[model samples]
Every structure is written in structure tokens, then in C-alpha cells.
Target: MSAMTTTPRTVTVRTSAAGFVGGIWHFARREFRDAIASKWFILYTIAFTVLAVGVSFLSLSGVGSHGFAGFGRTAAGLLNLIMLVVPLMALTAGAGSIAGERERGTLLYLLAQPVSRTQLLLGKYLGLAAALVCSLCIGFGVSAVVLAWRADGVGTGSFAMLMSFTAMLALSMLSLGMLISVISRRTGVATGVGLFTWLTLVFVSDLGLMASSIIFKLRVQEIFGLAALNPLQSFKMAVIVNMNASLDVLGPVGAYASQTLGGALPWLLASSLLAWTLAPLGLAMLLFGRRSSV
Candidate 1:
């Protein structure tokens, strides 16, 4: 008789992994790694920076011989451009996350694992948002200097409001992209559809509002009502209200007021932002559960 020696493998659960901590970390890590690896990130960033800087310089040059020039105007314009660009970038990061995996035949592998689809989406969503934060932080940080220079005694409250709205917009962008990802079988289709949707939501809504004004020839409140329904436009109107309180082109408080204790305009806009952030994410989760890529 021969004695057989065997070593048993012991299984151990990760003691540190608990609650949503692991999920959040994993999600953030995946997004940032992929973002850095993606060539589009670099190319778009460089193009945006060059254009923004060029515009800023042009605005600054317009002032008399460099004594605190018209730089603020340029800075605001650049900030607006950055705002527009960030959402698209966020959409690209998310819109194909799952669909690409499905197209590549890897999504099945993930589904077979013990992890839930919700976990997968959360991880990717967090990761994409984290990667995006870097660009936003840098871009906004630079623009803040310009904003401060042109403060003209405007309250710092508007700045705070703007930042809050910006963060929500970022979240909404990610959620919308995630939803689109599961809506298609192919990543290419998902991306195309997502971008088209973003354009429709962002630009088309404003056009519709313009059309309404012409069609109804309505007064201020009616025009405002039309703008309120569009999430992107609502956010824009809120930002403009807060960012340019000193200017009269908008209204008594820019375009609308913040904190709904007074009325609905500002808060309604904020609610729209929140809705965009949550609604798409919830819908994406539902779609992902039923999605099977083979």
C-alpha cells in the first residue's frame, strides 16, 4: 500500500470587502483605467484645451493693453464649452460599456459570474465618473480664476449653486449613457444612438422652445415653461441664473431663483437634473437584468 499525500486548498472570503465599499472601488477603478487607455480621451482633451485657451486669449486681447481685460467673458464662454463637452465625454464613457462587452462576447462571462448586473453597472458608472472628475476639476479650476476676476461683487452663492448643478449633470450624463448601453446589441449602435440622443436633449429642446415661442408668441412665463421641461436646458438656465446674477439679460435673479421655498423655477430645474441622474440609472438596471449577449 502506498500513502497518498494531498494538500487541501482552503477558501477564504475577503474580510475587508463588505457593503458597497468594494463595489464603489471596483466601479471607480474600471472607469478610470479604461478612460486613460482610450485614445479619444487624449485627443478630445487636447482639442478642447487648445480651443478654450485660444478663445480666452482673444477675449483678453480685446481689453485695453492688459489691465484685467475682457478675459472674464472669454473664460465664461470657455466654461460653457467645457460644460457641453463634459456630458458628451461622459456619455461616450458609459453608452458602450456593456454593449461593447456584449458585442465582443465577454458579457456572457460576466453574467455567468456570481456578481449581479447592478454591481457591474455601478462599478462602470463610478469608474467613468471618477475619470471624468479629473478633467472637470482641472478645467473648472482654471475657469474659476476668470470667474473670480469678473465677480463684480456677485455673491459666492451662485458659484456654489453652479458647482452643485455641474456635479448632478455629470451623474445624469453617466446614467443616460448606461441606459443607452443596454438598449442596443452592438456597441457601435449604442454609441451612435447615445450621441444622437444627447444632441436631441441638449440642442433640440432649445430649438423646440424657440419654435414654441414663435408658434405661441407667448409671454415670458410661457417661454420659461417650455425651457423648464428640458433637462439640459433647465440646467443651463439655472447655471446662467446663478453664474451671471450681476447681469440683467437673464432676469431679477439671473433667470430663475434657487431653493424652492420661494417658488419653483430654480428648484424645478434642479429636480430635472436629479431626475435625469436617477431615472436613467434605474432603467438601465432593469434592462441589464434581462440582457443576454450571445
Candidate 2:
């Protein structure tokens, strides 16, 4: 009774779901700032701009008697170019995100913060997506403006479709790159894997298809099924059909896809691309959650 007793005060700190979401946004903003400041982003933007403008100019200028003209041709050229470059750039950007952070010794400190793995991965993705989309818009937007001005508003619909396709394609590639980044222990390994993935998906896949058709003598339906598995192939087919380009060059698979899917081709391809964009990122998040940040 003579002794004075003091009880310790207990405080509980709970993070709301909304607070977690807010943290994600905060991290995303930081990532976006860092990405835009990168020299690689600047160079990519410039290269895209120059290539887009040059292709559009050559198509619309009528310099040669047999020179291609109109927005359709220009859009097609840009699609081909985008298919090659956007994927590469996106892979490079995404492949390094986590691995690079780890290499720089910043990832551990970031993990020490009151942030969940899901939030961090999603935040990084959003930031990278924004940066890539901005680069695409600037590059493609300039080309569109020039075409509308000089080409008398040709292929506006086709141009819009092309932009949509390119954006989706970029997202898909970025997701793949992020997956690679999450799996690799080092940035160099992530980058090598990313490049190999791009090369295999973009170029080797077509060769494999050709070989398969020769060896297996695949029917139209079988060929279409196989081609649809590749995101790049799906993108090309969707754009070609959307622009009403020649199907003769697409061969049997193209003809089958064009006729069989018909009005549904675009929707199917869009859905496939959406799957491509989500599946890898989802898997990476799961893996990242399980792996130790230390």
C-alpha cells in the first residue's frame, strides 16, 4: 500500500486498407519520378519520335513514283517498328526494376518500411506503365499530328487502333520483364533473360510456327490456335484485320483467323493481351511475396 505502482501504457497502431493503398500510390509516384529522370527514357523517346516522323514523312512525301502513301501504310510501318522497339525498351525498363534496386542496396531499406510486397510490386508496375505510356504517346502523338496535318486526316481510325494495340503490347512486355526481374537474383541475369524472352517471342516463335506447319502439316484451325498463343502474333493479326490489310500475305492461318474470328478477332486478341499483361505480374507478386527480401 505504501509503494506507488505505475502501469505501462499500451498503444496499438493499425494500418487501414485505404492507408495501404495510399502507400502504394506514394511509392508509385516516387518510381515515376525516378523513371522520367532516367537518360534511357529520354533516348527512347527521341528514337521513337524520329522513327515515327521519318516513316510518316516518307509515306506521305511522294518522293518516289512507287512510294507508299496514306495513313494505312504509315500505321503499318509504325506497328512493325513498335513491335520491335517497344517490347525491347519495356523489357529493359521492367527487367531491372527490382533486381536493379536490390543491386543498388536500396531494396532492403525499402523493404524495411511499413509496406507490403504486393503494394511495392503493383506500385512499381504502375510507375513503369505510366512512363512507357507517356513515351509512346509523345512519339506516336507527334506522328499522328504530322500525319493529320500533311496527309489530310488519313487513316485516323487506323492510327487510333494502332496506338491502342501498341499500348497493350507494351504493357504485356513490361509484365513479362517484371516477372524476369522478380526471378533473377541479379540485374544482369534479369536483363539477359528479358532479352532472350523478347527474341524468342518476337522472332523465334514465328520460325517455330513455320517449322511446325511443315513438319506436322497443321490444318488451318491448328495453325490459328498455335499463332494465337504468341502475343506478338495476336497483335499483328489484330492490327492487320482492324486496318483491313491484305490477308493474302498472312497465309492460311491469317485467312482462317480472319474468317473464323471475323468481327470477334479484335476482342479475342484484346482479351489475350489482357491475360498476357496480368498473368505474369500476378505470378511475380506471388513469388515476391514468398521470397525473402533479405
Candidate 3:
């Protein structure tokens, strides 16, 4: 009798756990299949691979003629390309996710399913994230193999670090894009807003900050603090400090900030990126829940 009672309890607990996970996975799998078949996925994978391989080749071209080149220069080149391309890819992918569903009249059907709003939203995000990871692995993995074969003195550690930061940046942008999607009721508006946000972060923020610093004669700490608020800036600073051999490439302001902060720069920048990733997603969830309840 005791064994039968214990078995029932065990079965109940297992069922509960499975139910909780099963709901999320159902939508996740569906969205993943859709994303895999999307045209954007194909373009992203091809573009990223081509850019990565091209950057590696150009960086290593000096090996035969002038002097030795390695992953250091390749990483720097790739960083610029990634800072431009990955954000656009992630932002567009995220921006279209929810709004596109709503536009197609599928979001209502999705909401009426057994899953809660939280599970549905979370599942979609994870599905998109998984697709992004798949693209990154294919793109970066191919480049890494090629570089290892062709380049001399390839710093695998630095390359890996760059890849890590790239993923973080992608996640950050994706969260922001989701927030925009939630706020905008239409897919067209969401796409436009996403592009505007990307432009502001990639170009306007850096230019405006640099101009302000120059005009105001901002101190090193002031510049760093302001720049840290922008994910792109933080990512650039973090990559420069961690990957590059010297701080000179970051210019005077960055070098001074590095000198002033010492070992704390990486942690600060990482914290900023983490905040960028989480805060937007939380806000989006809150807004989404409220709208759905209404």
C-alpha cells in the first residue's frame, strides 16, 4: 500500500514538471521551424559567413608580402563588421516576431492556446534565440576553421571572446527589438522603429557622444560613463580592452578610462550589456501581459 501511494505521488510530480515545460517547448519548436525556413535566416547565414571569411583573408593577406598577421587584426576587422551586421539581423528578426504574428492574425490563435502569455512570449523569444545561435555557429564556425588553416598565429582565445561578445550584443539588440515590437501595434511601424533604433545606437550615439565630449571637454570617467549606457559603445570598449594588445586603438579617451578603471572596465561594460538585455525583455513582458489582459 505504501509503495502504491509513493508511486502515485512521484507520477504526479513528474507530470506537473512536464506540463510546465511542455507548453513552452511546443511554441518554441513551431517558431524554430518557421525561422529556419525564413529568407532572413538564409541571408544572415550567407552574409555573416562571407564577411567573416573575407575579413580573415584580408587581415592575413600581408603574411606573404610584408610581415606576419594574425587573429588580432582579423578580430578587429570582424568586430566592426559584426557591430554593424549582427545588430541589424537580430533587430529585424526580433522586431518582426510578434508584430508579424499579430498582423497575420495568428497571435490571437496563439493566445487562445493552452499556454499562458508568459510561456508563449518566452517560447517565441527562445525560438528566435535558438535560430540566431544556429546561424552564429554556422557562420563563425566556418570562419574559425578557415582561419585556423590559413592564418598564422591565430589567437583562438581572442576569437572565442569576440564570438562571446557578439552573441551578447545580438541578445541585447533582440531584446530591444522585442520591446519595440510590443510597443508598436503594427509590423511596419515596428520595422521602421527598429531600424531607427539601430541607426541611433550605431551612428548617432557615437557621434553625439563624441561631439558632446569634445565640446564639453568631458573627463575620462564622464565619457566612459556616458558611453557605457549605449550597448554598442560598451561592446566596442569591452572588445577593445579584452582582445587587443593595447588600448591605443580606443583613442585617448578610452585609454584614459582604461587607466583610471584598471581591471574594472570589463565588468562594468558586461554589467551594462546585461542590463540592456534584461531590462527591455522585462518591460516588454509587462507591457505584453497588460495588453493581452485587456
Candidate 4:
């Protein structure tokens, strides 16, 4: 009799675990379908494709003696472009995910389900991530085809590395946007805050770092440390280190990071990005889970 009881209990436990995973996936698929049908999705897809193709064409126009731009130069230009665009897209998408649902009266029904808050939030992330990945593939695929046909010196390996960095940057920004969505009760507020955060990180932070370095006469390590704290800067550093032999393009701070970390710089920057991705999402989960109204 005891053996029979234990067998049923084990079976029930396994079933519960499987159901939990299935619920998360169900939400993810639902969200992805919804996103794919939205105007934002169409616009985002077009924006990424146009930007990628434009950058490819523009980068090739200024080739060196070989009459073709190398992967290094093309990768550098694309890195800057991705740094500008991907974060903005991810941030807006993330900011809209939860707060937008709440505003639309769907959050009430969603929370009425059997799914836990953590699972719901993670499912939303997975759905958004899948949508972003699809856009990246479409954009990168078109650009890669154009580059391969028009350019002879492109390095496939480096181009792939740049794509990886772009993904990481998007993930980090998405997490940050999720946190913003969790904090703000309204979609407008979340969107406004996300835009401000993007501006501060992409433009203001660079200016602040430069002023601090020049006026305060900060040390190399200090400047490098400051830059590493910003996810955009970290992504840029990772791409530059992977593509170029020297870090001098970033000036003394880059030189110092290169000399001190050597080959480990890319890994370090990647880790920083990973941290940025996780920390905000974790905080958002904690905050969202605590809300009794949702």
C-alpha cells in the first residue's frame, strides 16, 4: 500500500513540474503571437532592416587600398549603429510589456490564471526576446547577403561576434525596460522613463564621462571603470576589442583596459553585460511579485 501511495505522489510531482513549464510556454507563445501582429513589430522589423542595409552600403563606400572595407571597419560602424537602435527598440518593447497590459485591462485576466507572477514575467521576456531575435535575423541576414556579394574581405567570424554583442545589448536594455515597466503604473510613464534612460545612457553618460575625465583628470583605470558600468559602452568595448588589434581608438582608457586585461577584456565586458541583463530583471520580478493588486 505504501509503495502504491509513493508511486502516485511521484507521478503527481512530475506532472505538476511539467504543467508549470507548459504554462510559462503557453504565455510566451501567446505574447509572441500578439507582438507579431502589432504595428510596432512591423515598424521595428523595417527599421532594423533598413538600418542594417544602409550601414552596409555606407561602410563599403570608404574602403582602403583593397577596394573593399574589411570586417573590422564594417563591424565598427555597425556596432555604433546597433548600439543606437537596438537599445531603443528593446527599451520601448520592454516598457510596454507589463504596464501596457495593465493599462489595457488584460493584466487582471492574466493574473487570474494559474500561472505565478514570476512565470508570467519570464514568459513575457521570452516572447519579447524571440520577437527581437527574429528581427535581428531578418536584418542581419539581408545585410550579410549584401556584404558577401559586394565585399571580398569581410570576415564572417567577426561579423558573427558583432551580432552576438548586439543581442546581449538588447537583452540588457530589455531588462532595464522591464524594471521601468514594473515601477511605473502607467504605460506613458514607463515609456517616457525608458526614453529618458536610453538618452542618458547613450548620450548623456558619454558626455558626463568625458567631462569627468577632462575636468577631474581621472586616471585610466577610473575612466575605464566608469565606461564599463554603462551597458552600451561595455558592448562597444567588446566589439572593438574583438575586431581591432589596438584599443587606442578609445583613447587612453581603452589602452589601459587593453594592457591590463589583455585578451580577457572581451570576456570581462561580456560579463558586465550579462550582469546588467540579470540584475534588472531580477529586481523587476521581485517588485512585480510583491504587488497585491496585480
What is the TM-score of each predicted model, taking all chains together?
0.78, 0.91, 0.89, 0.91
How many residue pairs in model 1 have overlapping backbones?
3
**147-250 in candidate 4: lDDT tens per residue?**
87667645778778888888889999999999999888899999999999999999999999999999999999999999999999999999888878557788
Rank all candidate structures by their lDDT, best first, as comma-separated numbers: 4, 2, 3, 1
Candidate 2 residue-wise lDDT, 1-294, digit = tens? 677777777875769999889988987898889999999899999999999999888776763322125787787788788888899989989999999998898888998888888889999999999999999999989998888777777566777788899899999999999999998989999999999999998899989988999999989888888888888888887788777743446876777777777778788888888889999999989999999654
What does candidate 2 score in Cα RMSD to the true structure? 5.3
The candidates, ranked best first by TM-score, are 4, 2, 3, 1
TM-score of 1: 0.78
**Candidate 3 on 1-294: residue-level lDDT in tens?**
354544433332333767867887988898889998999999998999999989878877856522124777777788899889989988988899889988888889888866677777777888888888888878888878777777734576777788888888988899999889888878999999999999999999989998999899988778878888999988988898887533557777778877777788788888899999899989988899989432
Alpha-carbon RMSD, each predicted model: 5.0, 5.3, 5.9, 5.8
Q: What is the lDDT of candidate 2?
A: 0.85
- Candidate lDDT values, in order: 0.67, 0.85, 0.83, 0.86
For model 3, name the residue pairs that clash.
Answer: none
TM-score for candidate 4, please give it: 0.91
In model 2, what is the error at residue 268, expressed in angstroms? 0.8
Q: Give the distance in Å from residue 211's predicted Cα in candidate 1 to where it truly belongs.
A: 1.3
